[model samples]
Target chain A: MERGTQPVIKARVHVGLKAGVLDPQGKAVEHSLHALGFAGVHGVRTAKSFDLVLDETDPGKARTTVEAMCQQLLANTVIETYRIDIEG
Target chain B: MERGTQPVIKARVHVGLKAGVLDPQGKAVEHSLHALGFAGVHGVRTAKSFDLVLDETDPGKARTTVEAMCQQLLANTVIETYRIDIEG
Candidate 1:
């Protein structure tokens, strides 16, 4: 409720399947690429991204905390892997 | 022409937004959580995952090569982020 107050900082986390897993969507994309006349395209894979906003004062701490969030809450280490990128 | 040859290995990639970014899908999930009477859920973020199959002889080399693939083809560092997990 203050004028001139800096709003909270936010970070975005991108999590996707690692290479080696069977990606039907990616395979479809590859097929489409060939159909679209992109002959140079040999293999294709796809991934997803997410956007998040957190209430934190420090960027470093925020990154560490977010990593923990990814490890514990967001990603499944057994099947999937994730990476976090912070932007202010 | 071999009768018993090992099948190619595959990898999966998971990409998502950072925690600070705004995620509408995550917001919807959060709302649903609250509607379902699941209190204590402050924030929710959404992300996507992909599965990939590559014909590589070495797993380590495959991971390195996939990292390059992410940096070059898969993700846009300016607005999006991504991670790679390898499986054989």
Candidate 2:
């Protein structure tokens, strides 16, 4: 399908930091959860997810396309990894 | 289990803007993707995911606790919704 065309594909991309990386934000959340009396909370790490509607129809191509988008704009490969899920 | 205890609960919380809310960042990413020649992409929305390890063991309690966390810290209820997934 062409841009703005029918049969759009919906995609979700998840990006997360690599293991062993210092996550100050996640640490802060864990601290805050503990401070708020949710003492059972620990090891909290934050990540990102993206929802994209694509004009493409084929799932394979859509996944490939989103992979490039993640590398180019959505994720930092140096310290992060991304997974893409596509749906019709 | 007590805080910092063993056999921790792993919980994932997903937070996303409400359907009608504006997503300038998603739009910007969409625009940039098109500029990068991925013309078939559209309707991009960005969301957040949090991987949390809880000291609690019971799945039910973990979900309840994470729900409270989402309400108190993880999500802005006015403009966003959160979903919690719990695992051992």
Candidate 3:
């Protein structure tokens, strides 16, 4: 569909390090937060998000497309997890 | 609110390498995809996503809170960008 022809739907996807995976970057951030006086912070895991604008369509189909995108290109299932959100 | 008392809102966040950013992992993936016969794929940038379950409330407020979370903890503004999605 053309970009402006249809209602714009926004999809947000989040991928993060799975539990039991080592994240040196997250560990460094946690250390920094602790040094910055942020207490009560036990663990810090890092994640990512993607905001996509697509033509309005079937939510189920769109979700399936996105899930495929995640599996094929967006996420590393070996170390990360993903979720999707669609809004008009 | 208690976990079961409130409607579960799912938030997905995607973070990725910005343009001009170096991504060795992404480069490796691109190479692999090319070897696997996926042509027409020029540049590959890797990204991350997060799936969050939250208590239902005002969406605007929830978004603000999530934005803060992204800025403060979820994403690295230095090299990554993040987007949030909330669904009930």
Best by the TM-score measure: 2
Q: A40-82, model 1: which lDDT tens digit per residue?
A: 3344656655555555667787788667666765666676778
RMSD after CA superposition, every candidate = 8.8, 2.6, 7.5
Ranking by lDDT: 2, 3, 1
lDDT of 1 at A74: 62
Candidate 1 lDDT: 0.62
The per-residue C-alpha lDDT of model 3 at residue B77 equals 98
Off by over 4 Å in 2: A1-5, B1-5
What are the per-model DockQ values? Answer: 0.20, 0.85, 0.15
Put down candidate 3 lDDT per residue, B1-88, tens digits, no spaces.
2355654445666777778998887677557656655442334455765555545466676676567667887789998877788664
Error of 1 at A58 (Å): 1.6
The A-chain TM-scores of all the candidates are 0.72, 0.90, 0.81
Docking outcome class, model 1: incorrect
Error of 3 at B32 (Å): 13
**Local error of candidate 3 at B57, Å?**
22
TM-score of 3: 0.51
Cα shift from native, residue B53, model 1 (Å): 14
